[model samples]
Target: MATTPDDSSGQSTIDESASQVEILDADALADEPLPEDEAEPVDAVRPPGPSARQPAPLLPAMRPSSRPARSGDLLGYYLAEVRRYPLLDPEEEKELAIQYQDTGDPEAAQRLVTSNLRLVVKLAYQYHRQWANVLDLIQEGNVGLVEALSRYDPYRGIRFSSYAQYWIRAMILRFLMDNYRMVRLGSTRHGRKLFFQLQKERDHLIKQGIHPSTLALSKALNVPEQEVINVDQHLSAPAMSLDAPTSASGEGRPLNEVVGNDKAVNPEQDVARNELGEVFRAQLKTFETTLRDERERTIWHERLTASEPVSLTSLGKRYGVSKERIRQVEARMKRRLRDHLTRELGDEIPIYLEAPSD
Candidate 1:
């Protein structure tokens, strides 16, 4: 006797029985198609579904969105992402720095950079009031951070943050000096100090109920009074747009159009000055060579033509002559030069000599 399995729940369910045997004909089984779910055993390997079998997309179907275009929007995103990277403690920083320094491992360098991005952001924020584009400042500071990491000395007793702060602030300040205004701030050591600390010093003075004049600032900061005045003017001058309309008539005449081009070279004046200079130089050379007295020649070349003319007393001491003797020699030499120049170049000599005053 034979018993067939029952088909319930759309699947085959075998039943146990004693003394029951099931038989199948090979021709009948081969003629009928097996149901897909039924043909595969519970444990048998099966091909993936149609969705999975389809080709993968060329690009990710759900990639991370691009950063927004507006600065304000991007700033929020940057702050949130930067916060995700926790600051590194001294030990952690030292280890990563050492790893990078020894093996030049980029991954270790990356960890060091990511961990300290918050520090860059913090320093960049301090410069926020001074600059309009905070994001650009942060980007520059990040470059500084990378440089600091590359040059970091793990054996140094100082912490990485303290060391990195200098570079970070330096890069940001340099960027500001180069780009924050149409006119660049001076880069001399004293100029840089004044540029960076003038405002702070001024504020401190004001808080103390002291006037923040150039003299006061110069004394407080130990910078030259003129430098203090120059930096103060740079800080106070408002940025003017060249494209802005100049008048209420709405004629579209920009300030650039109305403003005189101070940089424009005066060809006429330049040519005249060049000709007069050549003439004066040739006549002066003749006069210098004609001088029979070596002392007079020395005084003429050393004292008169020097950019910072040496004092008469110094010249006299140098030549072991009295100051009165040196003055007389200089006067005679000047008269000879004036006469020679007048004879060679006529009225034009006075113009060139007088031009210096202007």
Candidate 2:
């Protein structure tokens, strides 16, 4: 059906639509409200630049210098102090000693004692070789030094070291006598004096190209003849080695009924049999070594025996790896044993035992 267009109404509708699209009324949009609270302002982000050059800060209460104090230097300082004081000076030492005796001036006494520490140390060195530990000797010597200082008499007309020698040696010998049960050495005063003097006398005799005779020693050191011989016996006895071969005859058994070829055959057989045993033993040892190195025996003992096998997953968890690694280790150990056997024997090596047929 053909219909004729209404030209006047069409032109009015088109014109109205164009006017509605073009014109947006500000009065209508003003009724719409905004959000309730205002948004916070964002910080301006700067681009990253070169790191700032700041010097490393010093530690709190740390020494500024790099050098450290040395032990030898400290020892030298102590030794120098000891060398200045000769154990005692009559007037000054007497005053210090009286302060200790009368008023109980422990501080004065400690000062006196500390100044003489190196003297104790020097004397201690003489006994160092006798004792197992230098520290033990030094400690004993210190005790001896203290006793000497306590019992010292100014009127004795003797040097401190000279008087202290008896006390020091007494303490050292007492310690040795108590400890060394192998032989009860130098317990008595006479024996103790002889112990030191005998050595010096013997050394002197040797230097003079004469044998160390008991009568000569008795005359020189004023000791009895029997004591010198006893000490000499202890020193001269040679120590025996515990590892020497045991045999009564001192050699091999004698052959009285020995013939020519038959007797020679026995020795040859012995050598061949021994060599064969050695070869097998060495191979067995090598096999055991390879098994141990691969940890095959250890794994069998730990896991497949009476002891329960730990979970592979648990082992993997501990090591931060997969359970497959644990399995691979077991497989590699097995492979290594077969490869080692093949290498040791030959490529065509046969199994000694095989499974029975059904």
Best by TM-score: 1
lDDT scores for all predictions? 0.50, 0.40
**How close is every model to the real structure, measured as TM-score?**
0.40, 0.32
Q: What lDDT is reached at residue 77 by model 1? A: 46
lDDT of 1 at 74: 42
lDDT (0-100) at residue 82 of candidate 2? 34
Clashes of each: 0, 0
lDDT of 1 by residue, 1-358 (tens): 0111132111222222211211122122223343334211111111222232121221111112244423434454444444444456778888887887788776676667666666666566555556644555666676566556655677744456655555566576666666533225444557556654666567668869999888999999997888777667655311211222322243323322222111222332332223223323434555667887888767655555542346778878888988888887877776776677555433210211210010
Candidate 2: misplaced stretches above 4 Å?
Answer: 1-91, 155-162, 181-197, 200-210, 213-358
